[model samples]
Target chain A: MNIEQINIKKSIQIYDELTKGRIINRHIYSSSTHSLIDNPLFQELRENLDIYTNQYQMSGHELIDDGEYFYLIYKKLESSTNQLIKTKVYSAIIVLVRCVTHLQARLYESIKNVNYGIEIKEINEIELPEEYLLILEKAKLGTLDKAVEYLADRSFLIKTNRDKYVLSNAGLSIVDEIVERQNG
Target chain B: MINYKSTIKYIVDYDEPFASLVEYMDQHSVTRVPVVFFELQVKQLIDKITKGTDRQIIDAISKAYALRNLKQHNFVTHDESNESIALTKFIEMFVRNMSEKMRVKPITDKRFKAHASQLTNILNEANSYVSKTTNDKANFREYLQDFLSEVKQDFESNKRAITLRTDNLSKLLKSSEAHGDQRLIYTKIVELCERYVEPFFQFISHTQDKNGFIPTMVRLREFFAEQEMLDEEAEVGRFILNFSSYTKDIQHVYDRINDYRRKGQQDLIVFNGFEKAFNHLSEIVMGMQDGLLVRNDLHNNQDFIESYKRFDNIKADNEKHGNVSINYTDLIEHFKNIEKDLVFSSRRSSQNSPLTQEINLERLALDKESASLLRARNQKNKQLILKISKLIKLHFSSFTKLEEPMDIIGDIHKILSAHMDDYRPFFTLYAYTNIRKKLLAIEKQGRIRVCVGYDQRKTFAYNGISYKYRPILIQDLT
Candidate 1:
């Protein structure tokens, strides 16, 4: 199976198992026993929820303890027809990011130019500009066209054809110039 | 007018046969020829070969020859792989015959297929991994490198335009620096600790060390402080204290009023300060009820227990007078009414009050600061309370990860007792029974188990089986 398919399955599993599966009894959670929410394990789980919710087209019950940390249980929006279509779209992004990153790595090696390939791990850490991240977080893989559209506006990359993209000359030049300046 | 070149250096491994085929196609004046060495999309091959070919001659060749081939033979006639070789050979034989014409180039079919497959895998693998691992930063970096490659080859090179503007370059550096900053890491960890750790445990010890107020009182002070109603806090405290005192003082005045009524005496303690004091206590009690409800949404057993104890304590002191002239039940009824009236009401309106208004403003100011010792102590208490409560709850569950069970049993019991609230009797009872049973079971089986129980201490049967009880420690579990 494809990488996108794997992610979709994993996502669905996480959604079904750890998060959506647990029944939240307010009476139990609100009681003295609810102190479980404060555990580091639960806190980590809650942070994971925040990250996922921000990246995918999903929502859940988020309990914030006075803005310090949060507890969230995400439920996939089963009613959204757009979400069903987005499954494929989300899969596409994984495919595209994978492909481009690989291609970039090869090109960088051949040219001995550090500016060529994408820093995939760094990209994940590098908080996307708020406007772009918001779009990406809410986007389904199927609406990758929309993702590309957002990227284009920011001059990150542009789609040359269906399922194909290349860094715009403008974007490429930026990295090239940065490297040149750095080397000097 | 655009010149495009296929990167066909790798195709020479299968070059000889392709050259022969092209010679034949060129001799036949075939255009739009197909290369069928691979059973793939031949159209892309045809487009690749004829990218810069002469339009007029190619157009005529396509109309006359391609159409005729299609009509006459159905052997995938006019297929680009077959005719393209013929066209190439024809061009080589008589180079002068087609001057200023668009020339077509044949790209080896095997080469195209090989590149396409590799590209597909590269794309697909990156796609799959991004979704599975959220925490694996390394994979994300790898995928990004791949993404850049696909983009680099696919676009036209423009040396001048690709250069980064100074601002964007600065942003890139700034962002990279931010990514590596230890402060960001510290902030995140602190945020995690606050969100996850501070809420559960009550740091009452710290409060005693730092400020004299108890955890609950600190919370109350904060609430009043936020309202800019500090004046009300002192008044409220005094008011509550006075009510407790009056519950005692009222007894004497009430008796005087009663005796006077019996004898029909005129000058009684009923007329002035005594009556005002009694009424004032009732008003304060009502105000407190409103304030408490606004601070928390709690309406369960703990709340009930707090109110019940306070009211009974006050009433018992008042009843020391044998006369019991005042109706204590009426005061209780008044307090209960205040709770019922404000049950679900939003406390936003309280912000408008002179008492809350300035306090809210000050809180807003405080929120901008990095950290507060007062807040820290408050959070410590919350964390301690939550930790104790969790330990008591977890005591009933079976220990799964522990290597030694005996030690855990003891540690859990200690945690339970330390944060124990008098109101949650069942929690303590259940915890005690479960811990006892697990210890006994550990000794009997030569193994340890942490068992959940619903208190039937006499039968000692938890989850339908009886077990011996003993204490477990933290080391035993870990």
Candidate 2:
């Protein structure tokens, strides 16, 4: 019922109307109908249906029927379970930033006010997860030599070249500050 | 009443050898026997067989006792010391006294008459043979003279026949000359055969007949067969080998005539009759060239000749007109004129203006109208070519075999006409080359002089060298 939801529903409605009220033919739902369904439009409709939930935008016109549309929505929800982790990771980065800023603010305010008896309690710890070490090791940041290196070693990326790096275990945990805060 | 001694008895009492061998028994003075006389007496005994009688009868009598049945004569069983006497007695009783008049009757039927006639024929034949054999020298001389005379006569007759043959051959040749050079050469060869080779062989045949070396009847039939043109080729061959030497004669005559022709003498001359049939024959032959038939058929019947003469009475009329020339020339000229007139008349229809003529002119106009159709078609073709060229120029492409458009409608006829002209030259050239090549190859392989194309010289190293002419073809424009 917000603008975002309204746009999504209107977009889907337009797509359905352009496709003559059917986004995918009913024939595509059955395994037996796969070979018989050869229209190039069917493939476009399939790709657009994947983007409908994942990217919130369709690439082409498609006329998918009710059953296929419902199944595609169900599959999108199932696949979007990974999106929850991604969302958690993003919120954790914000949380870490907030924790750092809050600590700095406290120090500055106390100093500016010049209060003699102002005492700070211990700042809450933003402990990175133990699994972060595994991610860092797997990334192989030792021999990276590109501006956007995937952090693997290869001959084209000599060790003496301009350096590049992937996040360490601690950095990875700190970058996920906003994600961790959202999850907590 | 026939006495026993004369009863058709075979005489054995005077058997010399037996008598001589036993004669010593009768003599008191015993002389040693002469083996020579004994042998001579034995020889004489064997020689005393009856003439004009079957030898079997006499042989049976000589070995009489050996043939006697032992069962029938018991007393005369076997005698060793006097075997000759035994044989003598057996012969005297059984064979010497026999007569057969009572058994078989005398053969006095028509067979006797036949036998008499046969005998007479044999005697006459014998007499003739004897006369021929005994005085054979004189008879042989006479026969030789007669043979020589007959040969001479035959030679004369052959000369006459040969003359006739030559005349006929010459006529044929002359006629063939009128026809074509090839036929003339062939006929001239035949003429030469008639004149020279046939006469000599005819002399040989006549001599063979007269000498009885060849039967007269056979020679006569042979001569008749050779002369009989109606006879089949094989039957004619059975007679005196009819070696025509015609080819040689034809060649000789051809050479002579060719020599004359090369010398540019008159093409034809008078050969027979007062008016000279040669010129007429030549003219007729010329007219009959290329297998044309000529019917000149002069007849001996005066009536027909008289009527023909009347029909042909232009001579006197021409003479009166002071033309004084042979009417035959005029006749030929007139005939030629008629032919020319016919040819000209046929061509006149196209040459003359159809409008001026009595025939339908509308058809001609229609034809001319239709004829413009091709001109329009040609214009359309030219336009199409120009358009296609302009369109194709942008592509920088020239025509290819496939891309070129053809008038498929009349292409078959066009191709036919084109191939007719194109193939003819090649056909002629190829035919000439093939025949020339074959002939030249044959010549090179040892055949002597053979004429070939237009005076080309070729040498053949074979048994004997010969020369031949290579004739040239004259250009004909028609």
Candidate 3:
């Protein structure tokens, strides 16, 4: 199939989301975006992302699509972006949530879309390593509450209440990426 | 059109046959690159499976990736191992067995499976490709490494795109330097994972027998779970303060019941605050009912003795005061109702209002003195007053000649107190009895006469002699 055969319109829309540093997750987008995803154009773009994105990224940026999401990774490596999660503690929380999501995804086939509310009081129930728990006992600011807020702000997990959270699309994707790497 | 050459090179570097070849070269100190050998193996595997249809090689390779995952995860196809007679024979049998294994319906029934959307449809297609590679063992791993390499490379190199963008996170934190202790914790975990866990199984794909070498990932994760200390739900404490909440409501009901005539019947018509408090108490009793059997039993005999004798006195007095008989059924049911509520809502202490600590030594003494006032709430002595309330009615409800209060107390005291020397001395009830408030409540109702007998003490037969204690009698209003 010729590269010209691909739908230029849908690819551009995906390009817009990716270049803006937004995660182009199908579930989070509008009906138009989702409908476009089902189009043959999107599949062509997904199959040959390097061809389309590289042509478009001649401005010195790169376009990439993981299995479930499409986003841009800056080659220049900006010091700070609005969506950048700065602290290691916050990363730890994301990793923890990722671990749980991976565990559940195995028992389930279509697990990503489902959001099981985990209570805040039940944070200690996730079966983490012993050494990590002892640090948590001493923390005032770096608690699960802090990590949850950081993740929630960026759409990884939704804070349903002061005591419970439901993993969002971004959250599940992060878990998928983490588990793949860890098990790889 | 797909980049099979480089992809095959990547897979061959990491996977079996070619992976073993590369490792073999390293061990033998071969200086020249084995790039040609790797490409030939890749071409040979793809040509064999696709029958010279090069594009279909991608499909075959996709299956190979899934096969590699299954192998790495050590997914078992058969309960027992089948000895391989020949390479072709084993591959054919293995494919047939694995197809059967994959065909089995998922074991657990989920009421609502997550919706299969377009994104997941693609994922499923990919997984199907992976699953189909089960029998592609000979041809699977050759070029499939392209897909794995792409995925693994993307994950390893461009992790930032997949994870949280760190700048957004830095704005909120004081920096690792400010919180040195927390930084230390993060450093240790990251460093250890890199050193131990990440490198633990890097080359296990080349090993045919990994059962003994590769520790199960699940066991490793569990160790990390404990080491990393993820907050688990099971470790949460104190959902509700069970003791204080129970007694606080019980005390409020007791106070309300005390204001009643015949413990609530008279106030059923005349009292203003009666209905609200009565209903609240009923609700409390209803909640307590579920936990009734499990809690410790706590009661004493004084209240039972006084309450029973008072029943006879009310009957005698009613003979003269006209026919204003107390409904024994309602009172008994109420006792059972209240008992149920208190026992079941066993865990309802208000989170905001726990027992306050005494401020000083003086307050401590006062707290002890007034401790009896909150005897039920404090859950001290474990005795329940509702039992006494019910027992008094049960004892007299059976009597044919309970015209006087004296006759009732005599029977109870004879069986319990006067038998200190009897075969089984049965005054266990005498340990802690409380009837002062309940009796006073009855007297204040002006319907029952809870009069203390003139002799404060009476004698009864025991051991062929006499035993003495208090013998109280009741006289109903005439």
Candidate 4:
């Protein structure tokens, strides 16, 4: 196949992955995992990034690249779905804070290191305040484990083991932004 | 004769009863112990000390009283009636000094004025001693020493009081219980600063008031320096140094309180922001649950935007990447071909294929005939409705002229029979029953007033079926 055909094939593949709601991170260890930034397909799409972005836009999906990660958002979001996403994000952050506070750990430091795994047992032991628990329950994340699983599914957390999970770079970036805003 | 010193020694040796007594007096801030109450306490103590005979307990009680009344021991003195025993001033001071438990009372303005007056009198006395003899100088030095000691003690106690108060307030402010009520914690901090800490700091550090505690101490230090009494000067210097240190300690506590207040304000702002976001999201969820097509303006709401920005790492500024324009006209056929391929693929995967089905002409003709018949029935029903409406209107027009309440069913039957050459009573009755149902519904909707009564004695027969007759009176309030 010619280079143009190869590029189009790679672009379609990357676009398909993004539309499936999988975050494309800069680093991926295994070649078996084809969605990594280092994949030849990703390199081909990067060479024609603007073309692919415009192509995705024509399809009613906005391609978002924050330098380190890539994701997609619909150009016109349904209001209910948007609100539900916001609620889930807020609930996750609030639960994260409560867990950090219960463990008597610094909020930013706890989430900054990708290798820093929070024990699932310790998270289950945390007794969140009633008000915070109510919010989580309303968002269908009534338990800390469920909230952790939700974040992991969204690529905000990485499940390192059956009982341990570490904050992903995307999650760390969010925490860093929040802390900076609070301190500032 | 009891050796008074040994008696005092004996009282101290039984640390249980005597120590317990001292603690009770200190905590209650009472110097006088009633005789009976004292005996009762001693008896209780003895019972605990030894499960001995009653006589032995009585002896322990007697010894306690004897120790209190010892003339030479002077531990306590009895009143004229001997009903109560008061600790001697010397013993009271000793206990207070030993315990180091000073009552935490903020120094009053009145007391500060008294100190200033006392210092002035001493300074005046020193100034009047012209051609001072050694005896006069000794007396002046003694007086200065006494005044400096008292000032030192007062300052020490005041420092202790401020430390204790601030420490308690700090613990409470940091406690989880206090977090449950942010407003209460805020009020407590404000009250501490306004009522106690600020005032005490001002009273000590008020340089504007020449007779203030700080200025008076400086004046005394200078007075001793003028006399060239090296020892007295050194003592006063040390006093001033101690005073400065105490003020610094209080200032440290004041800074801590300020920090807590600032932190509390920040926490409150954060808490309120989260609460607002949570409430707004909850309202949206509730609206959606109620089947409302709620517009979530959260993305555009300033407060919600601020909250979202805290958690949103992805910046929406996509202008840096150069925009690439595509010619949609050129790709239209290509997109249509891709769409057709997708549709074809999906169709191939299904169990049944739409293209394989054959159309049945016979079924089409039958459907057309049935549709025409249904249309005819609908048209007939519509005409029946119009006739029923006209008859009801006629009945209402002549309502006052008619003697008997209108038999709505009979009237509808009569109208149907007169209007059509061939009319089925069953169908007419069905139409009348439908009219009655509509009228009841209108009444329920509050568009009209209606009263329905059953006349059980009367039966209405339609097609060999009997239904009890019901008469309704409807008032059209509208």
**Which residues of candidate 1, in runs, are more than 4 Å off?**
A1-104, A108-150, A182-184, B1-478
TM match of model 2 to true structure: 0.13
Q: Which ten residues in a row have the lowest lDDT in candidate 3 chain A?
A: A104-113
Model 4 residue B444 CA deviation (Å) reads: 40
Q: Write the per-residue lDDT of candidate 3 for residues B1-478, one digit (tens) a residue.
A: 1243443443443244333333444456452324345345555665565665557455645444333332343321221233111112233223322342211111111201111122133233433443555565324333333433433332232222111212222222224433333233333333323332223222222112333211222232243254342431111111112223323433343233233213222111112222222233234333433554642111111221121110111111122232223345766876665554445433453233233222355766889878867875656324323434444445533322336775334555543443333222223224213444554565577645666666677665645766565655554554
Model 2 C-alpha lDDT per residue in residues B1-478, reported as the tens digit of each score: 2223422232353344434534532243232334444446555666775776578655644443122332133312334353322223343233322322111111222432333344334333433443465576355434434533443343343344343444554555456423234334443444345445443443333434443323432443443344352332233244334323333343444444344333221111100120222223223323323443333222211222232111121111112333222344666866665555445554444432332223345877988888899789898767644543343333213112323332221222223334343322223233334344444454465532343255454222212533232332221111
lDDT of 4 by residue, B188-240 (tens): 67666666666666666663376665576677677667767678778867876
What's the best-to-worst order under lDDT? Answer: 4, 3, 1, 2
Measured against the native two-chain assembly using Cα atoms, what DockQ does each of the candidate structures obtain, in the order listed? 0.01, 0.00, 0.01, 0.10
Better of 3 and 4 by lDDT: 4
lDDT score of residue B287 within candidate 3: 42
Candidate 2 per-residue C-alpha lDDT over A1-184 given as tens digits, one digit per residue, 9 for 90 to 100: 1334334554555344232211233222123331223333344445455444343224222222332222122222222212221222222222222222232222111211212111212221334333322222222221112211221110111111112222222223323332233233
Could you give the DockQ of candidate 2? 0.00
lDDT per residue (tens digit) for residues A35-145 in model 4: 222546446656667776877789776777766566776555423223444446556765665455333333233443334557667777876655556556656566777
Against the hidden reference, what TM-scores do the models get?
0.17, 0.13, 0.20, 0.39
Cα-lDDT of candidate 1: 0.34
Interface RMSD, candidates in the order listed: 34.0, 72.1, 36.6, 9.3
Residue-wise C-alpha lDDT for candidate 1, range A8-123, written one tens digit per residue: 55455444423321211111111233221233333333445445445433433333222322223223322222221122222223233422323222222211122333333433
